[model samples]
Target: MKETEHSNSSILKEIAELLNEETEIVAMLKGALVKFLNGTNFETGWIFFIDAKGRSELVVHENLPEALAHKDCHYLKKGGCWCVSRYRNEELKKASNIIECQRIESAIAADVGDHAGITHHATVPLQSGQERFGVLNVASKDTVRFSEDELALLESVAFQMGSAIKRILLTKQEQEMALVKERNRLARDLHDSVNQLLFSVTLTARAGIEMTEEDTVKEMFKEIQHLTQDALTEMRALIWQLRPKGLENGLLEAIKVYAEMLGLQLHVTVSGVLQFPSRIEETLFRIAQEALNNVRRHAGVAEAALYITVTATDILLVIRDEGRGFVMDKNTKLLSIGLQSIKDRAKAVGGTADWVSEIGKGTELLIRLPY
Candidate 1:
């Protein structure tokens, strides 16, 4: 008994170490599951997260018997079993052996074969404080029942796992809130201080140009005015990127305004509704601005068109311009078009960005993002 207790303590310590090291939610969950399976008598297991809306998402899974893993675990994928039902109804409050495993029973009825000596398994509800999140299921080859001591050890591990999950999620929310606060604060400071100073300089330079009598002095004033005006435009673009004031007016209008600011004309077409999730809206808006900047800088054209197709599951955006496109090489096209940055941004949002370009036919970039 003492040896068993010592082993459980070491496993718990190792799990705590792993949980502390992972900052991302999925990585943290995977680490917990791996540690749990590696240290316990259980040979196969999986974790599922039940959202506030009661939707179940399988987060991690480990080695299973061939029967249970058949057809990509078809029985596990769909839920109408006692475990899930008990979890949803708040009845699965403790770790205990689950009898009449419907999923395994179904597999057996179908003659999937190879139960590997397993007739029953254990189920535990994963929760933190008043917040209930998910369920953890574990089994071993041919194990008809799990001992009480083993169930207690599993519950202890699960309790820690649930607490760590809560910590990670709360940390992420706080960090996001702090980032937004800092961004807005910086944007306001820049607009009130540097942006205003540039506008004043531009006005003073214009006055100097009109008042000067000598041609040389007039030319100097003209240059000063032009440079200050250019500074103002760049400053505004930087501010917009930081806070995106135009985004409140919607993505299409925001792009139109930004393109005009860059001295380019924009044409837009849409095939679906305008509403989109907040993150998706921001991602696509930023990508659109980046594409338009590339158009004005390299395309040598004043006009661009955006074609948008919004569907039930995803959105597609195509930004195109008929200008002097560059050769599709590392030196000429990829670097000049800022392809890497666009691709990275899209990938972060679970999407893809690709471009089609030729020396004379201009370029078209397509971005597809799933909801």
Candidate 2:
């Protein structure tokens, strides 16, 4: 008995260490599964998470049986398993010992011939207070019923996992809020300080141009006025991109405003409703900003067309311009900062950025992002 208690203590200590080392929920769950299987009698373990759409998803697993794994388990697919259904229905509120797994039972009833040695399993809901994260399930080949102490230990681990998940989620929300606050602050500072200063400089330079008598002095003042106006334009674009008021309406509106600010005639066509996660919205906006900047500096075109198509699973953005196009392969080593930024932003959001360009023809930039 003392040895068993020591072993349980060691398991809890190892779990604490693993949780401390990991911050992301998926990585934390994967590490916890390995530690749990190594330290306990449980032969297999898996985690399920209820996504934003309220779909039960099998996120990670360890040491799953070959029969189940070979069958490409149905639970891992889009639909929910019996355990998750029971949990969702509030039938299985705690860790319960079972004589059979619902998945195996269904397979047998359906005569799928995949349930060879699968039998009993236990499931514990990973929850904290009123929030339900998902479930932690463990199974073994032997049909031995789990002990009270064993079930209790599993519940304790589930509690820890739930708490960690909740903490991480809250931390992420706080961080995002802080970022929005910082961006708003920076936008205000730029508008009130740098933006106003540039306007003052442009006005002063124009006045000097008119006041100067000598042609050389007048030309110098004209150059200063032109440069100051250019600086003002760039600063305004940066400020708007940082905190676009139009974005509150939607991404399409924001892009239209930005293009207008850049003095580019924009033709925009958007299909489907505009509803997306904040991260995805921000990513698409950044990519569009970079693309438009490239159009202004390199494309030397006055007009561009943006086509946006939204679907249930993904968002596609295409920006095309009939401007002077450059050779991509020869200039690969000389890719501009704007182009690099566009590519990086797309990749960061699990998306792809590709373009087709031909010399003296036109260029098309395409970006696809999964929601």
Candidate 3:
């Protein structure tokens, strides 16, 4: 009576806190998982999220058995368990109570650990309306059946989780859309203003060079003209990258065109299919552009090669040049700006960048992005 009412109040308070949370989805999920455990007698729990590809990934978990934790149990890596399979098959549309856990059963059968202690659990679908997000599973050490009220409470929490997940996803989409609009606006402004001004400056410098009779004056005009031309090329490249043409065809095609425009010999090799999130593809394209810019301005090499490997779990990009390489050190400040930008871009996509360079040995830039 009083205890149940107190528990319900705690659950409601947690739900209110969850509704007010503005953190990232993963962090919010972790908080909600903790709240769920606090509201129930379950000693352990986990959440799985279904991605765009319909693949179930173990996104969060709490308080697993020592043996399972030691084994580094990854449900996605193991191709999911019975609850996930049933969820995918649409068999567990509502709160499933006192069901056998095949994962724990298998672990016990193989003498994996004291997993026999966890014989069964209650699984519920985290969904809102017709949209399904994933599943939430909770289990206890002692064999205890959940009551009807407890199951209803779990369903309510799952609903809130689903709503939060949906809101976060919508927020991300809005942010991405906003970013694209801003990029387009900046691209247009650069093309109409700075790009036109640079073109005029190039023309004026060339005319001045032709009209000047003094050799020194002519040389200065020539230098001005060269600088203007270089600036114009760089500006055009920036505009093109800001709103890349033929990106829909794919990143490889776009890179091929860019390399052609730069008049650099490009050798491209691709292994496996190249498909990735839009942000990741965009980041890789920008990094490749930066690498090519380095090759053009400093490499002193006529050719470069780009190797790309795409897998279900990760994407690898490698750009190599047999050009005049320079010593890299934080104190020296040589090409640090561009390299740092590459690193930042890789990090933005949850990836990493490595630069291998030595004087007279050329340079190789490697990037790995995991999805």
The prediction achieving the highest TM-score against the true structure is 3
Better by TM-score, candidate 2 or 1: 2
Can you write out model 1's per-residue Cα lDDT over 1-371, one digit (the tens) per residue? 89988999999999989988888867887788788889888888888787554657677778777777778887677656677778887888999788868877877677786767666679898889988889888888878789999899889888988888889889988997898889899999999999999999999998998898999999999899899988888888878888887788888889889988988889999999989878789899889988988898789999999999998777999999999986765655435436777888899977999889899999999999976
The lDDT values for all models are 0.85, 0.82, 0.81
lDDT of 2: 0.82
Instruction: Estimate the TM-score of every prediction.
Output: 0.74, 0.80, 0.84
lDDT of 1: 0.85
| Candidate 1 pairs with clashing backbones | 116-142, 117-142, 118-142
lDDT by residue (tens digit), candidate 2, 1-371: 99999999899889988877777989999998899888988888888886455567678888876545645665344333667777778676788786556565555455644544557678898888888988898877665488898898898888888888888888889998998899899999999999999999989988998888999999998898899888988998888777877878888888888999999999998898878998899888888888988889788899999998999878999999999987767635666777888888888877998889888887899999988
Provide the clash count, candidate 3.
Answer: 0
- The local lDDT score (0 to 100) that residue 223 gets in candidate 3 is 94
